[model samples]
Target: MTDLPQELRLVTAIPGPKSQALAARKAAAVADGVGTTLSVYAAAAGGGVVVDVDGNSLIDLGSGIAVTTVGNSAPRVVDAVTAQVAAFTHTCFMVTPYDGYVEVAEALNRLTPGDHEKRTALFNSGAEAVENAVKIARAHTKRQAVVAFDHAYHGRTNLTMALTAKSMPYKSGFGPFAPETYRVPASYPYRDGGVSGPEAARTAIDLIEKQVGAGNLAAVIIEPIQGEGGFVEPAPGFLPALVAWCRENGVVFIADEVQTGFARTGDLFACDHEGIVPDLIVTAKGIAGGLPLSAVTGTAEIMNAAHVGGLGGTYGGNPLACAAALAAIETIEADGLVARAREIGELALGRLRKAQESDPRIGDVRGRGGMVAVELVKDAAGTPDPELTKQVAAAAHLRGVIVLTCGTYGNVLRLLPPLSISDELLTTGLEVLESVLAETRA
Candidate 1:
């Protein structure tokens, strides 16, 4: 416990002494392809905060992009990982089977929504899980077309890039993406053009029918809650309608829960909120408490459609990651992190709404569970105020708090605090945000 600082202590500016040095070194040592939010250079992390090497402690609101919901350095995750490393590092689950791999898969099957018998396949990343999901869907239906939604961010891989909506950074100049990939409008309520949930579904489905034709559609992939696309939660009834359409058309429905799963949105799986049982669900991020792991869980028939030896990668189910996943799942269940996510949502939404009342720049504050966000606007007219949002986040950073901005317009401030965050810490983070907004607006 002593490894973590009691409170924030900013001796120098944000990057401070150690972090600045590390950043300079990183510029030379690390790949420039990657992006960073804060350069605090974590020395230790637990509960709701991260302690930087510069000796400054910060209330973590990003939760490492919703990857550490159970908290960074969770005791169970640490113990399990350490034990696994001591036992054996890598035997490749495919080459030499391990109980941890099968155990984690079993957990995913049981934890994922739906009472039907399920099967699970582990992967090295969310992108891999998504790519595999498409393969399974295509194989199951014996179709060639895949339908994705706009503003979606599946991954950086070639196949996923075609499935993803954005192109500037993720898909720029790398096109000639996979064939038979089609896109439709996402259920974005804030910009739904005044259409109802069912109407939005129709708009998307109509396009699918006209362009791709349901006869050739293999899968309809969607994110229950758009993460990088501004944390946009689909309008009510939108998902159910789309899922129903898939059922009637013989298209497999795939839910990309990489960013919204593992209690990030109050439910174990975001699809559960609408009682939507998708044919396949892709999961990652918070699953292994920050470890690199992902999984595709779905109905037995759909997943098994792939011929034997058609699936499985060399490092697909690394022993270390499987151990961490087991421990992480156990931690989430035993510690009641799911309920804690609800408490976080209630506290954060309550404070953010109050702040919005006083600040007109706050266009809208919305989200579920620990995954909340506040969209900034230029004025009462509700034009995105990306500049002000960036300034507010920068101000919060200087004040020893870490915040992240999302949305295509970059005006949405996403709050993904660890579910284990203390009430006091959570309140302090919210207060910091309020203070920053007040100062920025003034």
Candidate 2:
């Protein structure tokens, strides 16, 4: 595994001298808008451990925010990228097309959910893919409005910023955002007070009809397992119902699998869990190991709706990125990482649930496969406790473990460990988390 130690080794404090010095330099050189969860500087990372500039090996539970499913610096990705760089780095696909780009599109078409005739277009980030998906939907349906859900996080760009639900850091003062976007209540079980899947879908669908008519809707996009929206998994029949509604209305149902695709959840794609096939699937994170690659894969007719010269970007499918994606996809299928994701989920869920027995502050623990989270609350009453969440994450960081927090209220401690991490490391990280929770609660 790239000659790095598989175990956590603390040679210095979490952010030792080297890292602190780098942090100081970063403050001066980098923009203040660029915030970091940890102060440590990564020197090398792979197979569950991120060796920092201070030589401290910390267990990686974030996986670069679910972007390194095949593990950082996977051999296959490295070799393919190395060979591609040596041969040729760029030849803009729109200008001088290459086999790598075509191969990646073929792979995405074959792998993403449905068995229908699909077409794929690559891009640089999840935001770009999402924007393009909306564009295609609009072109095909000749509609003007799109709908998103509460607590959703699309991206930082103009159109995606409008799609996202959160404010403050993501959307505050960033307007006037793209218009014709609307938001509706999502099925948040913990807070919904037992609203059934169908009921929740009706609530959302009714709102869409009343506020933004289906006749004007080009698309309705959602995260099957909402990511930044606190990893909230919509109720059992919620997604299916939404898909049916979209079909009846002739509006495209887009699945923003940017954070949930490529087996981050137990299934390869979150929609697979519900047998839901979205008209357009947007993917990015974990698609190319760690390279900057995203795509919009959809039915051929819808994807080709845009005029011949209407779509594409200069760096949409860089050769090296396409190569990395092909290799990473191969690695995932060959290694059976999907099954590994389920195993990680079981191990993590069991530990977290057991911990919740004593700590009433852990209001809920839910997720699929490697994507898991524990919602922190003030008590059994289920009042969000974002402060406690922050303390717990800080405590884990000091103990040579990396964890992340999310949710609309920022009270969910999310864990997204790489599937490549060994069971020992996973267990140890959980142990650290449990200890930290106990201390923080006390």
Candidate 3:
């Protein structure tokens, strides 16, 4: 474990002199494009707080952008990784296959939703999993066109950048992206004039049929609960409708559960919430308990469509990552984290909803399980309040809390606390947010 006391403690200021020094060094050494949300350099992290180099333990609400779902340095993950490291670090799966990789594949196929005969392939990142999923879909369907939803975040790779929606940080100047990719409206209830799920689905379907006909479409990918897109949960009936359409149209429905997989969304996967099984599912982030591992799990037929030489990479399914994934999955099941995520949602959503009632600036509170967020607005008109969101999050960070802001407008305050966090720590984090939000003016 990244060992330290579990409770939040402040020995020095948030970004104390030591952290400031490191920040200066980082500025000189690291690329300017690589951004940092929190200025404090992490010394260790476990349970609910990240102990900074300055000896201040700050509450961690982002969970490394939902990567450390089982909590950073979880005992099982640490032990498994330690063992695998001692055994052997890398041999390249493409050259010499390993048992850890096969074991992880078996686990993903069995644990992921759906009882159909499935296959699994491992990758090093969510973007690779996604790219491969697209490749598999295209090969199987013998089609070229693929569809992604608005506000979706696939990855930073050229092909994925085309699939992703937001423009600024994720897809600004990196143009000449891969071709034959399209975007459709997602069922965002708050933003879509409160459109019902079925209606929203119909609108998107109509657009797809007209702009990118099903005859040419290879896949339709979506995040059951969007991650970078403000943690937006699609309205009920939306996912199922899309799945049915995709099935009828001979199109592969890909669920990008990269950030919503494993126990982060109250269920093992966000797709489980709606009982919507995708033709292919992309997972990462929480999969390895912070170790870099991702996977594409789907029906055997579609997966096999890819020629043997088509998929896989050098570091795909590294032994240490595979070991960590297995242990992390074991921890999730044994600790009843799925139910714990539900409990967290109840607590956080309740508190945030109460805050919304009191503060008009809080435009909306949405999400399920441990993945909850509040949308900041300038007025009752629901105008985005990016500045207020920034101030509130900065205030929280300065006062020893680590919250993150997201959404296309940067008006969302997303909270992804570790499931292992204590009620007291979680409650205190909420209270800190409430205080910061309350103290705000203009």
Candidate 4:
């Protein structure tokens, strides 16, 4: 296990002296608009953990929101990036056209879960990828309306903000958002106001058909599992029903797998589990291992809707990110991370389900692969307990484990532990979490 580093040393309290000092500096330098998870400074990170500047090691269950799927600084990623940087940083793939960009595109096309002839357009972030997907959909369908779901998160850009359902930090003052964006109720069986998945899907489609009309709809965009909104998996028949509806209606089905892709959810893509084939798939988070790279992979016909010159950015396909992506894909394949993710899902689900059964406060325990979550509630009646969730996350942080809270109500603690995390580290982190829960209860 030493080959993977299973150390979680806490010489001082979290945000120890050094971390506090750095955080104070960061508050002045960084924008307050961006909320931080843990202010602890990273000295270095590898495998499943991050060592802070204050000499504390933390079991990183968040994985930078599922970016470092292969673990921080995998040797292959580092080697590929180092070599690529030494050669040239950015030649602007549009202008210079390097082999790395094409190779990465080829990899994405092959791996993005569709047997159809696929094409990929790489961009800088998930939002850009999402926006481009909409552009493609609109261009292909010649329609204006795009449909999203309640409790869905696409990105922070203007068009994505219009697509996003939350109103707080993402879209409080940012309106009048892009036009032609529509929202429908998602198959959130947990809190669907008593509607089943099929019912929710039918209700949503009925509403769309009434207000926007299917003929005007360009696409129906959704996250396979809503990420920022909470790790809410749809009801059994929800996604397939929606996909079929979109297919019959000529509306593009765009799966926002930015957070769920790259084996984070026990599969290469979450849509694979449902046997759903999206017309377009938007990916980011784990794509380039740790770099900022995102892409939209879709059928060649639809993706080609955008004019050749209309779908690119200056650093859309950075060589470094492409190289890292190549290595990250290879690493995921070579190390059998997909199977490892299933193992993680089984372990996490088993433990969290046990916790749920024992503690009425745990309203729900759900998620796939390493992307599991525990929703806290005040009673067995599902009264959200955001306070308890916050307390547990903070307690876990103090105990040398990093946990993140999410959901519209802020009552869910989502886990995105690296697939490479050793059994020792996984259990250790879970133990800390259980201890934190016990302390919170007391």
| Candidate with maximal lDDT | 2
Clashes of each: 0, 0, 0, 0
Ranked by TM-score, the better of candidates 1 and 3 is 3
Root-mean-square deviation of every model: 1.4, 0.7, 1.0, 1.3
Candidate 4 residue lDDT tens string, 49-131: 99999888899899998999999988899999999999999989989999998999999999988799999999999999999
TM-score of each: 0.97, 0.99, 0.99, 0.98
lDDT per residue as tens, model 2, 294-334: 99999999999999978899999999999999999999999
Q: Using TM-score as the measure, which candidate wins?
A: 2
**By TM-score: ranked, best first:** 2, 3, 4, 1
Clash pairs of candidate 4? Answer: none
Candidate 4 ranges with C-alpha deviation above 4 Å:
1-4, 193-195
lDDT of 3 by residue, 33-64 (tens): 99999899998899989998888999999899
Shift in Å, residue 428, candidate 3: 0.7
lDDT at residue 298 of model 1 (Cα atoms)? 97
TM-score winner between 1 and 2, please give it: 2
Off by over 4 Å in 3: 1-3
